[model samples]
Target: MAGYSLERLNFLVVDDNKHMRALVKTILHALGSKSVVEAADGADAFKELRHFPADIIICDWNMSPLDGLDFVRLVRTGKDSPNPFAAIIMLTGHTEMHRVVEARDAGVHEFLAKPISAKALYSRIRAIIERPRPFIRTATYFGPDRRRRQIEYKGRERRKTVKQEQVVDQSSVGLSQAEVEALLSG
Candidate 1:
């Protein structure tokens, strides 16, 4: 929070609870973010995204008409997606391993458990800005790479190399490398 400013970033907060939305907005505003949009549900979020071009999306897990998982899927793979590469942070009270796996599988970039704190929120945003994951395109997945580690691979590659393309370009959605380094070092 001390090193970087969120003023250059645009954010979208999607949640079914009005209070929750307000709380998140307060946190974002306090962090120097002036461009924060709110959506009551995933459907509304999509509508807002069509015009907002959010740099990061903070969304809740449960909502009517469209849940967070479905929304993430659409944002990642839908033909009409406004910004498939936008970083997503899923906020939910469900801390179960299965729920986390489900959210990860649906293309969420970060998962934040509920009872949210400004510190936790800021940390998640920092992680996104500091280490943006490359997008991976496959027959079934077209979102950020699910892998989080760099363990050495001892086994031969099983999948065909042609079928997977790693998208490493982040110029359009985030700050340049120089900008990020300056912020982190400041």
Candidate 2:
């Protein structure tokens, strides 16, 4: 315990159940986070994101209004706005491979099954922050010999853009600029 210390991380826990939210908040507090915000559902989560932007988001996948996948997609691809970068972890009860693939495609940083424990949450959070995912974009490299190489997101599908195409401002693409700014700051 000499060198071990809790990380001063900011977190947002989204769940429709009050008991579940409280449990997550307690875990976050035990982990040394001074700030933990709670949201009843995806709509509430989006509202919380607008104000108390979080460094990490742990959201239940079955909420009404927006649901976990929609939230992840909203924050990740920035639908109707700009892309935000806060690490997103989706909580789900299903272990289906297709579900996991869908989550990844929606830009989730990680997926966790239901009944999350403090140890699992902490470990996953540390791993994700230490080795954050990359956001790849296609670009044209003009060297002695002009050439173009497409950057891919590995497993995820992205807009196929031709080489040398001017990069569209992230804000101009999808999610609002304000939402993107909040995500970036988070």
The top-ranked prediction according to TM-score is 1
What's each prediction's clash count? Answer: 0, 8
lDDT of 1 by residue, 117-168 (tens): 9998998899898888877778778777776655456788654563434535
How well is each residue in 84-113 modelled by candidate 2, as lDDT tens digits?
677777777754666755666676666666
Give lDDT per model, in order: 0.84, 0.65
Clash pairs, candidate 2, are 78-175, 79-175, 80-174, 80-175, 81-174, 81-175, 81-176, 82-175
Error of 1 at 5 (Å): 0.7
Ten consecutive residues with minimal summed lDDT in candidate 2? 140-149
Q: Which residue pairs show backbone clashes in model 1? A: none
TM-score for each predicted model, relative to the true structure? 0.84, 0.69
